[model samples]
Target chain A: MKTTDNASASLAEQSNDEYSVRITGFWSGRSELIVPALVFILAGFLTYGTATMKVMGTSVPGPQFFPTIVCVLLFLMAIIHTIQILRTRRFPHEDSEGQNADFSTDLLSDLADTENEAIYVPTARPSVTGKRKAYSDWKTLGMVAGAVAAFILALPVLGWILSAAGLFWVVCRALGSKRPLFDLSVAILFSSAIQLAFNAGLGLNLPSGFLEGLI
Target chain B: MESLSLLMEGFSQALTPMNLLWVVIGAVLGTAVGVLPGLGSAMAVALLLPITFSLEPTAAFIMFAGVYFGGLFGDSTSGILLNTPGNSSAIASTFEGHRMALDGRAAKALATAAMGAFIGGLIATTVVVFFAPVLVKMATAFGPAEYFALAVFAFLAISSVVSDSVVKGLMSLGLGLVLALVGVDGPSGTARYTLGMPELFDGMSIVVITVGLLALGEVLHIASRIHRDETAVRVESKGRPRLDLSDIRRAMPAWLRGTAFGVPFGVIPAGGSEVPTFMAYGLEKKLAARNGDTDFGTTGSIRGVAAPEAAANATAGTAMGALLALGLPTSATAAIMLAAFQQYGMQPGPLLFERSGPMVWTLLASLFIGLVILLVLNMQFAVLWAKLLLIPRHYLYAGITVLSVLGVYAISSSIVDLWILLGVGLLGFMMRRYKFPLAPVLIAVILGPLAETELRRALTVSQGDLSILIDSPVTIVLYGLLAITLVITGIQHLRHSKTARSQALKFDTDKLGV
Candidate 1:
């Protein structure tokens, strides 16, 4: 209650953060396990590459020595991380008690050096272990990913202004923007301003594909 | 007297109409980004790195200095108004700053922060004018072995101190080292991990890493979880941000003490101002408790805001000193500055003072100039800056995503780069979601090459004798400092872990530390 008394809007999460973080099944999604799994694969690849590295160095510590050390350490850390994940059975946002400890579920927790781990004073006992759950939001996320892909593929052909504007529209849509017409107008205006700033201001040449020579 | 005269010569250049404009623009832009929850000066500079490619080196650096200091000045705004710190460094300020706002002292909190930042940055920059040359002399004396030792020291200290989990920090370090190793090996001319992509012959650019990880990755992460997270609650902080005489009296000593806590960390390789700001806050809280002057957690306390704000800017100013003198960036923002230096065919080490002495001086002098400009702008317009948070999150992130891609493409004009940007953005999203410390990745990518090159060069010189690394006194001292840092961090970790395990599903109400 004392912790709840002093907490901000974000502190509301800890008390009622009943988000279902059911990352289940071997073939399904254990999103928390993905990072470690990827590192494991990367380590294996690096190990193979190190053994077969070309140009055997004439020096004492050659080109492959450092990679070998890095790969080995990567493997060791990945194993420990995997074991830790499996043993705790905790989601990314959960503490060791398997309770949601992610402050302010917004993604700001990422680069922010918050003591989300085994640190910090426990604020208050969450009176309610609520049943709300957060999902991956793959549909919207996939749309955003698709938008970036489309922009990358179409940049040279569609030009900076058009491709950038299109990317902006799709990303806005992905982020749950419903006003397509207004979004498109804002996208066009924004991209064009960037174009003007870079071209007329910075003197860098951004391609003008369909809008070529149109100012 | 010579340093004083050189500083004056720098002032002469910084006073120019053009450079002065850069300072104002950079300070304003830096403050804008710093006020946003998801943006920081590091990403702003990284996005601008490519655009600054064509500008004169001096003007670009002047703007960079402005942006760097400006971010620190503005970081406490949102913290005071919304209780949502724009970044971790401002979290310390938010504790009491927000309390002050709730107590109807929002103006006082903002004013305390602005003035504290101004004084801290000014004092630290002045110290740099005198202190950096000694550092430069030491950097000048560094041999290959000593350079390698320093890099190792930086790598170990940052990885250990920055992350709570030692394994995660090292893994992040490993990932960065792998990225740094992607291009051709300088000595052997054999590529490490390019995967036959011609665009990667030069390895990855710092612009891509910083922009992708800090800027675009954030956009993607937020988009993925847009609905799950609660929307930030903003309170309208009205009134002019003017501190009273009594407020100033209480804050003045705290400001100096916080700056003292910050300057040493400026030279240390531990990334970010988090540790220093938190320490400043902790010290102020302890002192306040001892004196019974003010209630810390319940009511508002100006000392809390003043100390952390001053510490944040103090660290930023001295970080600049570390960047210019030692060519060793002490924070992520400084790391990007170091990258900007390399992009301009200039390496920021001892040689920089001799080769581009004027530019370094101008950058340092403009820090002072930037602080003056930021104090005026922030004190008068704290409310206006808070309004920036009202921009819709979707549009804000959308703008960031598009601008980041465009900025990266502008640099090299390669389709491959855009693809890599997306890849790195995804990587950044994952890292952010999983609590991976992003500083080690940036620092390692920047320092990994130097470490490898120097290690090999030292080994080559010694005819395969590894003892050459330990033969030098400088290397010995550097490693000794690293050892001490590890021990201190380890003890801190153990103490924190014990407290963490003591609690089940609740926070430790009596204890303080976040």
Candidate 2:
């Protein structure tokens, strides 16, 4: 809402003055473009450095080939873009300047305001009762991360079913399923279905987990 | 007669009970997933990919094609009825279809949209069937340089034309190329970007990248805005959509014109459908305005519904052609479908046409059948589909997140994939938030290795003579097409700017209270 108010105020100012210095059009005063451009340069440098290192018979095209190509393209595009922005900034009358005058101003202001709001928006405080809730939404992220970690840690020793079911249960809980019994049942059923379809139906040699001997 | 015989054989293969079952299942599942807001075709295909691992390649692709077409049709239903487009392609339909829905003519709008889609789809498929063989014959002669050039063309076309800014689009593509560079270098058999991590030696799975980025990323995005009061409500249909003589007469020209606008743009690498649909809509509006149809917006002009709907489906069909022939996916959905093709150890290129001609023909044959199925399904069960809007957003998205995690895990029993999924999901969320188009990223990732391998091989073959790129007629023609596409798009942008200027002038005049 603050962003909306800011955008509206900017629009009002733009409309009020006909000869004001207007920062307008695409790529107008946005810093996010710098991130990708810098990333390209860094990636290119790393790729070039790696490629220079030789290993055995195949030196891997000196790493600089592919990365350099990508980097150069990105750099050229960025340069062309920066030039266009500057050119537009300098020459305001060669084209339909008056027409874009309002539209671009509105767009820039809206974008700037929205970005400001995103940066400045304060986090909501949880109520006293909300703090003690059994299943926190953030716990879902933790559970998923835990499930994946558990799968990796236990897959060799505990096998597929144990790890898969653990994953399934964690994911289901993350999704707000509260019934432990139902969650376990669903997980077992899903694992069995997968085992049957992949191992039995298609003859894929999937890890049978602890159920390796039974069936 | 020879082509007719091949067609008959294709129908025989396509009409089998087993294939029919797959088609129906695919359509049903595709539509269901597509109707769910934020679950696009790419996610649907990626999630179902694990299931396809157990099926025959033919049956797997049969179902994939069914899902692809069905998703397109299904997305339009939500776009029209709920004013929530499931994919960016359906955004234009929301403009007029929602207006018609507000006017209590939802049924008519739905009917017109379905019919227009059917016509556009059928025409495009027919074009594909005839044009594919010739294109394949030409593509067979292409060496690595030509192939690399073609990939460049695709990258240039999609990045420049699809996104609002060419810079952001190219940046998204650079990100994809970087992601693709991870894991072992295929040509030289050395680690590239693995960064001392053994798990990354095999590289990140496309399944993980796609599911994490598209599905899980979408869920996180929705969750970030959970407090927002945006929810889809089911709109009750007043009655069955009727095609009155007058309405049909009015919509017919728009349908034809829409197809004209759509078919060409679809063949181009621009993944976005906004251009053609908007072009059709603007043209129709201008023509109607000239005829003194001042009530165009208020009365819900038939052209409004017809042009965008036809253009949307036409673009969908031609996009498939580009994918099947060039192995370049212009959109996320096409990129996922490309992954599906790769899953079967099949590369969709000139060889696919030569070796799997029957399957290709049959797939094209099924598209015709699928259109009829879509028409019948959309016209009769539209209200039923509109009910999908009532499903709680939290539950739907939560379920999808669960499925996405499961899907990536299912592909490889490795926990590392899950970690990759989470990482890619974060990346996807960032890209979306930053307005970087995701399609180019997918295309670049999928095609990067291929481009590298081919470029190396071509250089080896030609002994490093770069002029070999333009030596062939096919490559020449392709370059010509790319040049023409760039010029045309540039002109179109200029024209669009001019139109915007006129509109602005008109707005200023009105603001002066003249």
Candidate 3:
């Protein structure tokens, strides 16, 4: 529990750190402002969408009524968040060593070094005691997202067993599993076992894909 | 005397050979899943819900009781063994339980946790058996306005008091409300946010969101950190785990006190076991200090392990009572259980007891049976369960990922649900990454529609006059509690900031003096 807490705590602190560094073509520490900005945009969109919702002639509130209330509240929160980000950026910390700036530059250097590898190499990083590093492995996260996307696209075509196996294999490899052959075998075996249990034993209809005739 | 006779009838029904087998299977499976980090009783019940479609309602609920008890019992096992709590409920247990494990008292720690859970659950269940009718009577008295106030109180308590950042917590709550508004309006019968997709007409499925957020999101979050080797503290129990006389004497009062703190939390919609466990841990720590036992946060205090584990299971048991009596689910697991009842065309309330009297009593009886089964299984197999951590992290995570996808796909058999699952999984991952507490989101999703419906009902009764909301004494009291909680949290926040400033100043002055 402490480990998970620290894991999240460090991510929060890392974003705080990111809020103090300069990204190219943006204001100082502006990279971390993206999520809040996106939230603001979403709030605007929701508010507009709620406005366009058709109201029924009913005694009580319309369907658009509750959504409009929530959208306004969301908009208020997003504005507050935006203001907070702006305030933090306006008042830069007056540290002598520029530690956060140095760390961000070092992070960028590492990112540049790993441009070809497609995975973040964490070996050369300094071990900061008492604080876990943020989840900075964006490439791995992207691969995971890609795996799920592929799974969704392939489920209808390749069937539950094959698509699920493909998902397992992709996720395992993306998470740095070294044994491809072993992972492949386990993935196939695991998915197949689920297929047999759910489809054969439980009599649930799992899509057979091209194996409809073969199986 | 009438209740006792009904309980006996329930026992007779639950003690059947097939039901007993189901109980054992549910207990073992629940424990196995609960020992895995990030999965709790809620997810275990959610995954098992589809299978129960084939079974009799009584037998199915009996199995659910086993799963619920076993999950609470096994959750603390991982917290003690690896310092990785199976769920938020076990967070407090990991504080001193892991230290106890590291100090070569792994067996003693396990014994303390299991015993505490047994005593707490047993007592809480008894409390339920005696007090459920009274609770049902109280629940019957609650009007829609009062229910709305209670929902507001729950939302405020969870969003403002439970989270590290009130803004983030409220943001999560808002997001859940937005998601909840996806379907057609219940009262007005108007389509608001379905966006022309017929699939969205029923709103988002709780199972998909939960599995996506808790299970898959956790997998993704951990995957991003997979480069680092997890430094798990593996301490095996050397022999049969047993609580000595002194251990038992020391833990008994703490367990009772913890149960006292946990029971009321169950009645209220205070989210889940996390809050009570922490409160129990804090209370026990202070009591230990008062008792001149200073070996806390260091040498591993038995009171620490006892209090939190007891409080967690106590909350679990009483939450069931609240669910059964009030038809109100205070936690995510209880919410899923409510959905299970609904699947069988049963609504759990005063009417449920009158309608399905035998099933209700049997379900309550099976909770006691499940508690005993869990105690025996966990006490004897503490060391064996610790070996579950020895599975390679990669395979374990990969396998869980497979199960997660399979579970979501099997439910409703909709590819659209899978897409929603993936989207929600990413949302959950981002929330975790950004340090937004997931509980508020979950609680809001589960409670949003109820809040909306109750509010509308209250308004309809008063012909859209908003003043009717606060007309009732129950509504006023709930709103007063919400206000007081907010003020207390505000004062605490101010004090925290002041202390932080003073500490920073003192550090600077000391450095200059040096």
Query: Considering every candidate listed, which one attains the maximal DockQ?
Result: 1
lDDT tens readout by residue for model 2, B1-514 = 4556676788889999998878777777777776666676678899889767878877877787778877767776777677666655565566677768877888888888878887777777777777766667767777787888878787877776545455667777777887787777766666776767888888878888888778877665454434322344545677876789998898998888888888887767666465677667767767877898864667566677788778877877887887788676766678888888888888888888777878877877777777777778877887787777776554466457656766776786677787788778866755654455677778888888887777767766777677777887767888888888678656655765576567655543333334
| Candidate 3 runs further than 4 Å off | A1-32, A89-134, B498-514
How does residue B244 of candidate 3 score in lDDT?
Answer: 80
Cα shift from native, residue B400, model 1 (Å): 0.6
RMSD in Å for all candidates: 5.8, 8.5, 8.4
**Regions of model 1 farther than 4 Å from truth:** A1-30, A94-132, A213-215, B498-514
Please say which candidate is ahead in DockQ: 2 or 3.
3
**Candidate whose TM-score is highest:** 1
Question: How much is the lDDT of residue B166 in candidate 1?
Answer: 75
Question: Candidate 3 on B1-514: residue-level lDDT in tens?
Answer: 6778888998998899998988898888778777876677777776677656667888888888888888888888888877777766776777788889888898898889989889889988988998898888888898888878877777767766756556776787788787777877878767767778998888888778878887788778777656644445566668878988998898889889889877888887767777777778878777777888976868899998998888988998899998898887777678778867876889887789989999999999889899989899889997887788777777877787778777777777898988998888888777766566676677777778888888888877888899999997888888888888789777765665476457645533332233
**DockQ, computed on Cα atoms, for candidate 2:** 0.11
The DockQ values of the predictions, listed in order, are: 0.29, 0.11, 0.19
Error of 3 at A143 (Å): 1.8
Cα deviation at B235, candidate 1, in Å, is 1.8
| B366 Cα displacement, candidate 2 (Å) | 1.8
Clashing pairs in 2: A51-A62, A51-A63, A160-A209
Error of 3 at B141 (Å): 1.7
Per-model B-chain TM-score: 0.96, 0.91, 0.93
CAPRI accuracy category, model 3: incorrect
